[model samples]
Target chain A: MDTFLQVLIAGVTMGCIYAFVALGFTLTIAAAGVVNFSYSEWVTYGGFFGVTLYSIVGLPLWAALIGTVILCVIMGYVFQWVVFRPLEGRHFLTIVTATIGISVSMGALATLVWGPYPLTLPTFFGNGTVEFGGISFFPHNVLIIVLAIALISVLQFCLTKTDIGLRLQATAQDPDAARLMGIPVRRMRTFAYCLSAGLAGLSGFLVAPLFVVTTTMGFGLMLKGLAATIVGGWGSLKGAVFGGLIIGIVEALGAAYISSEYKDVIAFLIIIVVLLFRPRGLFPERIAEKL
Target chain B: MRILSKSVIAAALAMSFAQVAFADDIKLGMVIGTTGPFAGGEAPLVNGTKMAVEDINAKGGIKGNKIQLIIEDTGSEQTGAINAYNRILDQEPSAIMNTTVSGFVLSQMGTIGDEGIPTLTGAASAQLALDKKGVEPLFRVRTSDLYVAKAAARFAIDNLGGKKIAVLRANSEFGNSWLNQIQSVLTDKSVKPVAVESFEVADRDFTPQILRIKDAGADVVIVSGDPPHFVVAVQQLKQLGLTSKVIFSNAGVLPTTIKLYQGDSANGIYGTVDSVPAIDPARADWAKRYREKFNIDSDYSAAEYYDGVMMVAAAIAKVGTDHEALVKEMRTIKDYAGIGNTYSYADKGDGGRSVAIVQIGDGKLTLAATIK
Candidate 1:
């Protein structure tokens, strides 16, 4: 029972990270109408930004996170303007290829700037463990779960119960109709892009303390997040959350109960099974439907 | 003006040709990961190689022919490493120096064998020696993983008084070889590991494995892997509140790896190191010079490669650049003092024979015992 509790905590923490990154994917896909694969780079850059502010510049953690998120939001705005605006109506492959190019370029740029060494970030609670009933839990793990739930709740509330959120969803659902109804489609896309980038930045900051920050760290998370997005059904926010949590739990439980060697294969195996059965993901509904 | 420009260009070309013609410099190829996973560790090796080449050249060269070091980036992938090797081979270097990644070396063995160039690497996989019977030109500059595993296993059982043992390793060729060596060492002592687990090199989360180890009630855990895998594993194990005595492979004790550990998690953990400069005061001058030159702490990985380059130079000085002659000379070198160890290439191309066990405490690695 103690072992199960430990595994569950780890699985949930990992699931939250994946869900956070997947949130970035769903937002851009919904509002921008483009699957921005470069969300991973945003995650990487966000971590670097936080590292610089928190570790290098010696700011408090909260201030650093806020600064990092703001910087990432600006980066997203620029990214959309520079990469997406020029080729907005082009073939889907063209934009995706450009985003891919951005991803590769950002990785190289990170290496050039940061010099390829893994940078360490201090944990929010300073590596203190909370134990109960002979089971141990890292304070950061509990913090991740809480923060993720809070962020998701805040996002859900704004999107469903707020005016600006409705406009954004309207723009995403039918841009032509939204424009006819006096909703600035371009502005809505830009807003969602910036918000998504901010979310990516938050994910990076949250993940930095858990894993050493490396230029290549984003790639693995990106792959997992991409998988989570697909498993949850692309463009579905709830799907992203469920998918991320499920993958993380399966991976933890699989490694614990079965073979550690095939743990990754097990998490991915769920994706295959999901795709085979649900096809649209576990939620089987788009963000537009939720709105 | 045109005539003058043409004359200037002609003079430049003539000087370049004259320099090349007059200077028959020996070429050495350095292939390492400058951009990928191993880049952090491999960077120091590059610095060491560069320092060696520069020092040798400044000392009037090898028999009046200055050494020209050609460095290439491997990108820390097998394909990238192979491409780097091919690029270096285009220069037809007299010898090649590779990184500490065993997988890269294993992948490039066929090419290195075909080229028949004397190759030196710090990769610690014991499989290299097992495969060295047919490959004459390959030499391991660092202590083999087998020896480290043996030393770690023995220290864990005898020194730390550990009874129930757990083995957690990276899922790689190096890790697999180290696990086998540890198991073999334990078997000789009639002991069995309580649990054995492996994680991917890129994995950041290790709680699942730690939980399993805790559940097994292992008193000691032997971790076989490189940094940041080693660094993260130790941190996670500590974070997950495991009080087991932990032993790590050589990479665990590195200054780069040590500096990344969260809080005092690394304080009580034991790790294997190829050399302890503190034990040998003779390394002070070299360490000081390295610090002054590279602006970084001198590590055994760097020292091994530095010694490797110097050893290659000594062999070239003895038998010239002939590959077979140099190989023979390298084998004949006895008690060649280096920054890390007194390297004398063994029959199986293992130059360094000893491993030092160190315990991390108070922000430094304190040498506990030297195992031979």
Candidate 2:
């Protein structure tokens, strides 16, 4: 029972990270109407930015995280204008290819700036293990699990029960109609981009303590998050969350129970099985009826 | 027409003079991992190479002809390693200083042999030194994994008095070879490992593996992984409260890795090293110089590279610029005291003959024993 609990916690913690990254993917697909493949690079940028502010610049941890999120927001805004907007009227594949190129360029730029050494940020709770109700946990792991849940819940509330979110959704559903109805479609899309970028930054910050900060860190997260997004439902926010958790939990449980060497294979096998059966994922996106 | 002929003749004469000067300088080529997962280890290796080049030139270079050092970055990938090798070869160097990655070296063995360049490497895999295809010109400048693995297994059993060992290794050629070597040593002693597992190089979490090791009730766990992977494993092992005496391979015992690791997690951990210049009084001068120069503590990889370059310089000095002659002279190197270890070039391409076992106390390494 203790072993199961330990594995569960590990899985859930990892799941939160993947879910956070997957949310960015789902948001971009919904609002921007195009997948930003560069979310992977944005996650890496978040880590390097955290390292720069907290480790090199000596900012307090909370201040550094906020600064990182803001930087990512600005990065998204600039990218939308510089890269996305210029390529918006072209084919969808063009935008995706450009985003992929941007990911590569960002990775190279990071290597040039940070000099390729894997760095670590100091954890909030230090190295002390926390014991609660007869179970031991790394305090950072607990922090990741709790903070991810709280932030995700707040984001869900803002999206589902707020005026700006309705406007954003209107823009996503039909930008031409939304523009005719006095909604600033361009600004709405920009906001979605910023929000998603901020989420990616937060995920990267959360993962930095658990993993070393490296230029290559985001690629793995990107793969897992993309898998999660697909498995949950294409563009459904709730699906992204559940999908990430499933992948993380399954990966951890498989590693613990079956062969550790084939852990990734097992998690990916879940994807194959899910796709074969459900096709559109566990929770398919709902399309509103046309008049 | 007369003026044009004069200018052409002058240009041709100057070009020939330039070529003569270039030929007078001995070009030594190097390929080291400058990016990706191997970057931390690359730091010391690069610094050591730089220092060696400087020292050799300052003492009046090989045969009074200054050594020209040309380096290429491997990007820590197989393709990158091969590309770096080709780029270095384009310079038409006298000899090539090899990459520290065993897999990288193995991939390029045929090319290196075909080129017939005297190549020296710090790669610890015993396979590199074997009498195999296209490895005749390769020389290992560090202690091979066979000796390091033996020392680690022996230390775990004899020094730590650990029984019921568990092995967690990276799923790579280097990791598997080290596992085999260590297991062979254990089996020779009539001891068998309780459990064994493997993980990819990029894996960050080791909770599953640690829990399994705990479940197996292992008294000792031998980990074969690079710095980044090993650092995570150590932290997770501590987080899960594993009481096993953990032993790590050499790459994870470097100063850069020690600095990245949380201090408490590293305490009581034992690791094998090619050298511990920090604790070895004989290497105090070199270590001090390295720290002052690079503003970083030198690890064995750096020292090995330094020794490799110096060995090449020595070979060039003894046998001039002839590659075959240089290879013969390199093999004759006996009791050549380097900053890392005293090297004697064996017939199997081995140079360095010793390994050290160290224990981490409060994140700092203390030399436990040196095995030769």
Candidate 3:
């Protein structure tokens, strides 16, 4: 039972991380209708940025995270203008290839800037443990998990209940129709990029507490996020959250109950199995009827 | 086969082209990870080897010839390693220095076994590389995981007196070799493990594993994974308030793990390190030289590969480029003072190999005792 609880907490904590990373994926897909494959690089950028500001430049931890996210935002805008912006109106495949190229470039740039060594961030919550009703979690993990949930809730609320959120959702659903309704499509897409970059930053900040801040850290998270997107249904905000958390929990449980070596592989297999059965997802997006 | 035919033709052409009054610099083949997972170990290794060649020429050219190291980044894959070999072979390098991951080395082991290239590996410590299945002609300048695991196990049993241990190994070849070497040693000593399990190299959480160890009455945990993977395990161990001696293997060389574990939590943790971070003034002087050379804090890699370059240079001096002759010369190396270890290559690929148990006593590794 104790083992079960520990695995649960760990799964949720990491699943939250996978969600934030996948949320970045979901946002870009929603706003631009293109899966920005470079999403993982943003997460990696956040980690490298965290290392520089926190370790090298000696900024406060909180400021470092904020600074890293700011950089992530700037990078997103730059890549949009420099790479994705130029390739617009081309085939979706072209855009995806460009995004992949951008990802590789970002990885190389981060590699050059930080060197290939995995950077270390100071444990944000210290080396403290919190015992809750006979179960325990690392204090830092609790912080990450809470932050992920709160941010996810805030995202859902803003999307379903706010004015800008509606405009953004309109833009995602039908950019041409949204533009006819006075929504600036380009701005909305850029907004999505910025939002995606921020979410990636948050994911990296959360994971940095758990592991070393390596340039390659985001690759695994990105793969898991891809699994999340597929399982949750691409561009469905709520589904991304649900699917990401499910993927994380299942992966953790699989590692515990089955072979840990096949943890990542198992998650992908589950996504494939899910796709074979329910091609859309466990929770498909609702279609509004025009009576 | 086509590439090889082309390579042979190119080598012959290059030899013929050399005498056309255009003396192209002698190309020394170099292979190391330029990208992918094991690039961490490969990058610094290449950097040091390149720096050594530069230093040699800065003082004086090698035998009135400027040595040119022609590098090919083997992308941590067997196909890449073979391509690198073919490309460098076409360039007519006198010898090849390879950068390969564990499984990739075994993949090329046959090539070196049949071809008898005087190959030197910067990394890849799978036991099979040195086992009977390995290419007889292959040799590692870098210490094998066999010696590393042996050193770690010997330290735990002899110094830490750690019995009732928990073994947490990663799923990779390096991790499997670590578990295999340690388990055999423990078995010989009649010490049974509390629980043995495996984790993937990219496993993010280890709490379940830790809790299992806690329940099983494990007093010590021997973790074998990459630095990031092992760091999570150690940090998780600390979070669980499990103060059992968390002795890590060679993977503990990453200083980032110490930082992630917070201040002084890594102090009592033992490892078979490359650098005795605490050493007499002589070793400190070597560290100073290393720091000045690399403009970074030197770790086990800096010490280990610096020594490896010197050993390979000694081999060159003793046998002068004959593959069998150099291998024989390396076999006779004895008590040679190396930056990492002071010894010679044994009959197998392990020469000049010595493993020592070092502990982080005051935020820096100090020699606990030699595992002689």
The TM-score of candidate 2 is 0.93
Stretches of model 3 off by over 4 angstroms after superposition: A257-273, A286-291, B1-26, B76-79, B124-131, B255-260, B274-282, B318-337, B342-349
Candidate ranking (TM-score, best to worst)? 2, 1, 3
Q: How far off is model 2, as Cα RMSD?
A: 3.5
Q: How well is candidate 3 docked (DockQ)?
A: 0.47
DockQ of each: 0.65, 0.59, 0.47
Q: A196-244 in candidate 1: lDDT tens per residue?
A: 9999998898888777788777888888888888899878777888889
In model 2, state the lDDT of residue A207. Answer: 86
Single out the weakest 10-residue window by summed lDDT for candidate 2 chain B.
Answer: B128-137
What's each prediction's TM-score? 0.92, 0.93, 0.89
Q: In model 3 chain A, where is the ten-residue run with the lowest total lDDT?
A: A282-291
Candidate 1 chain A: minimum summed lDDT over ten consecutive residues — where?
A: A282-291
lDDT for each candidate structure: 0.84, 0.84, 0.73
Question: Residue B24's C-alpha lDDT in candidate 1?
Answer: 90
- Scored by lDDT, model 3 comes in at 0.73
Error of 3 at A176 (Å): 3.1
Question: Which residues of candidate 2, in runs, are more than 4 Å off?
Answer: A286-291, B1-19
- Model 3: per-residue lDDT, tens digit, B133-213? 566556565556667777777677777777778888888787888888888888888988888878767677887677767
